[model samples]
Target: LQKACQSQENNRAGLGADKKEWIRTEDILERLEKVSDDRIYRVKDALRLGVPVNSVKKLTNIDPWYLMQIKELVKLENELMKFNIPEDIPEDFFRTLKVHGYSDAQIAWLMRVEEKDVTRQRKKLDIRRTYKMVDTCAAEFEAKTPYFYSTFDTENESIPSDRKKIVVLGSGPNRIGQGIEFDYCCVHGVKAAKEAGYEAIMINCNPETVSTDFDIADKLYFEPIYWEHIEEILELEKPEGVIVQLGGQTALKLAEKIVNAGYNIIGSSFDAMDLAEDRGRFSDLLKNENIPYPRYGVAEDVDEALRIANEVSYPVLVRPSYVLGGQRMRIVINDEELERHVLSIFKHMPDNRVLIDQFLERAKEAEVDAIFDGEELLIMGIMEHIEPAGIHSGDSSAVLPTYSLSEQAIETMKKYTAQLAKALNIKGLINIQFAIKDDHVYVIEANPRASRTTPFIAKAYQVPFLNIATHVMLGSKKIKDFEFEKKLEGYAIKVPVFSFNKFPNVDKQLGPEMKSTGEAIRFIDDLNDPFFRKLDSERSMYLSR
Candidate 1:
């Protein structure tokens, strides 16, 4: 829609009159049906291109009322092109824009200005967002649930409470890389907050999540996990602190924004997060701490990426920084693949920095989930990946109480986890990945927030690790205060479940990028038991099927 709007503006400036391109209605229907998320935008685009409403409706079978609604939004966008930011715009104009669900980022794009500039203008004009309660009853009886959604109206139903509160942001949606695992962490964190005598407020957009249930948190805000929505919620609630460490990368990306807005992050500071996320800075930290890591280098362009790959040798793992689920990650075995991967990455994310590291093939992979209270660290559990280092952790089958690692390697990983937690000042949960080759331990990466394995480990060991970490973040408990059992009696395996039938033609091979949509767990008294072997065989056969 934005592209179509820009094209219309260009045509007006260059041709001096609106010209319509004759397109078939069948093509419009094809675009609408194939691109599910952009159907409404496609309608707006078709209308902007002068596709008649009668033709569109006759082919697409969409109601005319809906088409008119989209037409209004398109008209609004055309009017928006005439104004600039912070000047020549009436204060009341934003109220209408907000009523039409125009985010500050969208307005900024239309006005060809930075998003922050639009934000500053909105603040200057005091055109803040208001909240409306999601009432099940239509005022026949008073609704007791505190669920709310944002709007540009005058009356606000979500009144601030005097009691101290902590805001927990939920992972936005369920997808291949991030799924219900992070939602498990968020739900546990909210429960812990209420148990610690503070009202818990949850901000999430997914209605399918347990955290979005009306009774899960003291107050629920069913809003997008974007910075603008989160900032508005914080502006109204003024919570004592915000917990971002349990919500996965979706919430973790907003750490700097929350800090810059003068709100307190309940756990590790933004600098710590940056230190862990920034490839060069993290490598420097590991070098200073005498930690073993794969040889790596950062790059900004194709030439630099190829140079790093040559230095690191062949079979290098390349990925963009500050990404979760190993999105756009690959193992390039030669210069040709390196150039191709770097070009593809830059084409999609032009401003992103690429991190090229030596790929450890046939190396055993393990992960550790631990917690820290600024002074002491507790290792929750250690999971050994059934597959090797190349497969993304989320897509790999992992066995808890590590079935294959030697005692020495396990101790070394635990020591490294503690050292990193203390060095990074982690107050809540931390997940660290390790690669073992020739009896040597190397740190692959570190995540300051909860991992997808958090819930799996908790269920297998019957431990409340998330609860403990939440208390640690709230400063109400320490690692020494809890009686944590690090060792388990039996073996537990987490097998990745894929929905291949739903997505036709997708490659079934697991690699650096995650592909599994969900997971299933299996437990047994012995790893060599017949039932365990049978289940393992079934899991192995799934990939081929």
Candidate 2:
């Protein structure tokens, strides 16, 4: 060590005994090993203490590749500190990426982590990045970006003087066909804004969608929906008001955040949204309103989950407390499959928080889309699912202006939808899914924000849903009192499109889980000859519309 220092000093100007040749001294190696966490820390100190770099390397022999790993680790930590991580990452995300032909360096590059620091926070956040789950990667990273100034404003943006007011919130493409639906909302929202002689402003990240095509809104900003980015949009483009409930949960969630951040929101409150999502709360609400739902229980651990699973008689549905669309949901018919799928997800999530319920089969499913302004509820229309209730409505075939409805069932459905809407005090579009078994109506789910079916309803009914929702956000009341463009012609059927053939080995069957690439809506009133919703060999379907 002393000799190493002498060589470094010799290269410099003349020096005294302080730079004299020296030998390795007692306890230096032991002292270093006892305190230094890694070679880089030791090297930094040695260089600061005037010891030669070569001598440090010669003594430690730490691999250059390993040093690079350490640096990457530090960089990744700094990055994560800026943003939050999502509750879900592909199971075995890193390992799966590796198996699917990604090198360690490549995996590290994509994850922005050091090869050395890829340790799982829990096995749940393990390295998995299947094509299906890839889009979720940016959510957490985007969420963590440090907020900017001017994102917080206690005052809401006022309406325009020269034009009508339309505020658009975008839902970026996540898994399934959700992205296109948002585009649908943006297109109609802007059109509605134009019809009402108002300016339209949009916030979205996806440039690939039609919403980002520039002509959709007067002002379009490609910003992350993080609190910081959204708050920035709210501050800069203070429109008459904000729209949240039209773009699905991602947009709605951000809207809730905006409300929490002290900005004026144009739709339902965050508390109302929470009631619509929580299974226990929702079920209780339904019961209180005399709406029937399947018997269910919340499970906290394996023992309780298993017990509930047994009571539900093998076939049961399991879903997380808060999810966009059944991301981890599944139907289990046996103990083995139950244990395989249930254990991992339940173990990671809050115990006794999962909705474990008996699976209802052979139930005719239907949907009701409506509009409200916190005072009165207006039923937009009722539609029946082409497939049974088990298939995700997004993936199921649906007919607008339901066919098999009994007058009693129709009246009951309308009343329940209105009741739920009024009780929630929501001020925008709301969709409710119900299943009729033995002539009893059961409320399955409710979306305070837009459902996948919103675009279909708007296009079919020729209603400016975006404009109406926008007005509701601005304190307008009574959708019935306002005139709506009558566009319902004949009948419409919405058929789902899939890319399963292009991506092999993906599970195709649906339940609470959603898995459709896109959809097509067909219009025809000739109920005489039924068409079989044609699917080309490529999994793309062409509907009449």
Candidate 3:
């Protein structure tokens, strides 16, 4: 059983608490070659319940050292539970907890208080973290690489430079909705920062992305996206400003907190981001601009959602506010489905409000990537989705230089795009999605930051959109100062790639929620290609394997 659990741990397969009994009874140790997170939690629980460390080690075949560490963690939790208020928290106590990898949220759970309270207490204690260099050459030679990490220990390795610097927070991880596209933007932003004679600093945790590469920027900090982690880096770097627009929802979500802490935001203001994300605020803006949008309502409860559904009529689209890649978004056709969906959403995200919009069936969906430099707005490229509305834009295939929309409609979209950008006072990249039904265009969504389509649009137009946006954000250039290629002679189709074959048990159906893992772009000189005929002929040959 121990060998089986070890194997499972190696495979990264999680086992449940129910597997404990099976481990005791079944000799199917060969079948149980992995351990799960729940199994480790069970061990912790057993240790907390006064089970001897040696006994746990005997049963699970885990190292005695690991068991002792778990025992210490449990003891710490028990000690933390004894504290009643902020006054009871000793100065060194919080520092010790942080050194043990106790996050503010975890400490909050133990202390029965809000996470913000923990943050406040930590700040009161003045327990700041120090930054350390990665030291790729073992400190043998002075390295120019900016790779760094944070630690509670004393010695600081991040020496402040004399050059003006712009800190770029990278998207923490490569999850769906926030992936390589944002990294692409970050890389370009770093390059632009260097070209503009400012030291570029990148902070991110994901090792899978180019943004985290040691040499990508002047300084790189591999750190979590938590408030405390960012605060520490900011204290050390003391940058001219931080750029949040290129980091996707991860960095965008931090704008409010960072701004509230009085840090300078270089690109779009937090108010602009809030206006774009908050459904109520965005709806008001659209109304003021006379921009058409689907009838929608925001609800904090199931009753409110149901009422909104009735007002919007059946088949309403629902999503949580401030989410990317259409996470947990769904379309419901009836009251029963709506209620069930709302309940499920609230189960995981109780604080989030539901946004209900009248589903526009058979609408032609389109996307526009534009750059706004406070005064002037430049539309980079307009992409029309091949699949009709309802499919998530990230998962839908799109064609550049829209093949479907009329010239007049395209012009109207550009006008609306500029109007929205100016109204928001945007200073960098902004992406907007629209739906056209019955010859009327309705705004579906607007992101006041770089969208996944920025890279694709940039490649299509043969212009570095992110680089230009970065310079614009830094007050180096305006929209009209640079010559841009607005039109391309050929068509480019963005085809989404899926990882469904790797997860056979998961459903392959695509809908409002994004499901594609990656995307590929294919450019053809002519509308009709013999290459497509060859692809059709070879489809069966590829599928058989």
| Maximum-lDDT candidate | 1
| TM-score versus the correct structure, for each prediction | 0.91, 0.66, 0.87
lDDT of 2 by residue, 201-299 (tens): 776666677876655666565544444345545644556666777667667766556777576666777778888887778888888888778888777
Tens digit of per-residue lDDT, candidate 3, span 131-209 = 7778788879987667887777767778888889899988776767778989999999999999999999998877889
Q: Which RMSD does model 3 reach against the true structure?
A: 6.2
Residue 180's lDDT in candidate 3: 94
Quote the positional error of residue 145 for candidate 3 in Å. 2.5
Question: Which tens-of-lDDT digit does each residue in 102-179 have in candidate 1?
Answer: 767677767878878888888888888888898868888988899998877888889999999999998887877889
Which candidate number has the best TM-score? 1
- Candidate number that wins on lDDT, 2 or 3: 3
Which lDDT value does model 2 have at 285?
87
What is the lDDT for 83 in model 3?
Answer: 93
C-alpha local distance difference test of each model: 0.83, 0.62, 0.80
Misplaced by over 4 Å in model 3 are 1-68, 114-117, 138-144, 530-545
Ranking, TM-score, top scorer first: 1, 3, 2
